[model samples]
Target: MKREMIEDALIQPTILLVEPDDKVRPSLMDNLHSWGYTLIVALSETDAMQRVQGKGEPFDLLLMNQVGHSVAELVAIGRDICQHAGLPPSIPVVVMAECYGDDLEGQDVQMGDYEYVAYLEDGQQLKELLYLLCPVP
Candidate 1:
């Protein structure tokens, strides 16, 4: 089936993307939008929270690129935002990182209501993770 046709079959799920880098946003947005996800790009934690709170509907998933800020900071802000919005902790979150080895010590990212996806890994791994999170119709 065609890509557009498949995307049309599923509900238009909203995705909150938190990435500081401007260069990566366009490509990521294009790829996700093609799959029928409504992308709300935020360059910082504050922007992300504002968009999430101000929006009419809560995002189906939150995707964060942990580059500019510390993981702890990101997790804390993310959790707080979700809590403030009265959203359950079970909401799926995908965190992108360079290295998510055993060294990172923090309950925020390690044992949270979200899932972790290593950004340094290959594209196939990322694709699989995304498929697992949001299956195609």
Candidate 2:
């Protein structure tokens, strides 16, 4: 019998997480990492933008925590990054926030041109949303 190569194993999806809070960022990273995700943690929008600009390849998904920034700012940044990267305007972008219900009002934004769910209440919800956006191999 032939042995299977390590490369034959399924590869996990990569996610770019833009979260500013020190307390939340680590925990989120730990959880996602344990879940077999390749996480790129960016502390701020600027940092996140730099990473996206430098990386030659596009991430499977983008997870952003709208903590310090305004909704308009976040949306604009997200849109610009996707457009600059040549990714679809409807690329998967998961926005997590403490005041999502209120902050997200009138955003009229959808992930991949479909209704997007806000994973604000629970961390697991974010993971689930990511799975929906980009399935694990």
Please give the TM-score that candidate 1 achieves against the real structure: 0.72
Considering only N, C-alpha and C atoms within 3 Å, which residue pairs clash in candidate 2?
none
**Model 2 lDDT tens row, 26-123:** 88889988777887778887777777775445777777777777655676677676666666665777666456456654343564462253635456
For model 1, the superposed segments whose C-alpha errors exceed 4 Å read 1-9, 99-110
TM-score of every model? Answer: 0.72, 0.75
Weakest lDDT window of 10 consecutive positions for candidate 1:
104-113
Q: Cα deviation in Å at residue 111, candidate 2? A: 6.4
Candidate 2 residue runs with Cα over 4 Å from true position: 1-9, 54-57, 100-119
Give the per-residue lDDT of model 1 (tens digit) for 46-127: 7777776743458767778887666566666677666655677866677777446655423133345475544444545655
**TM-score top scorer:** 2
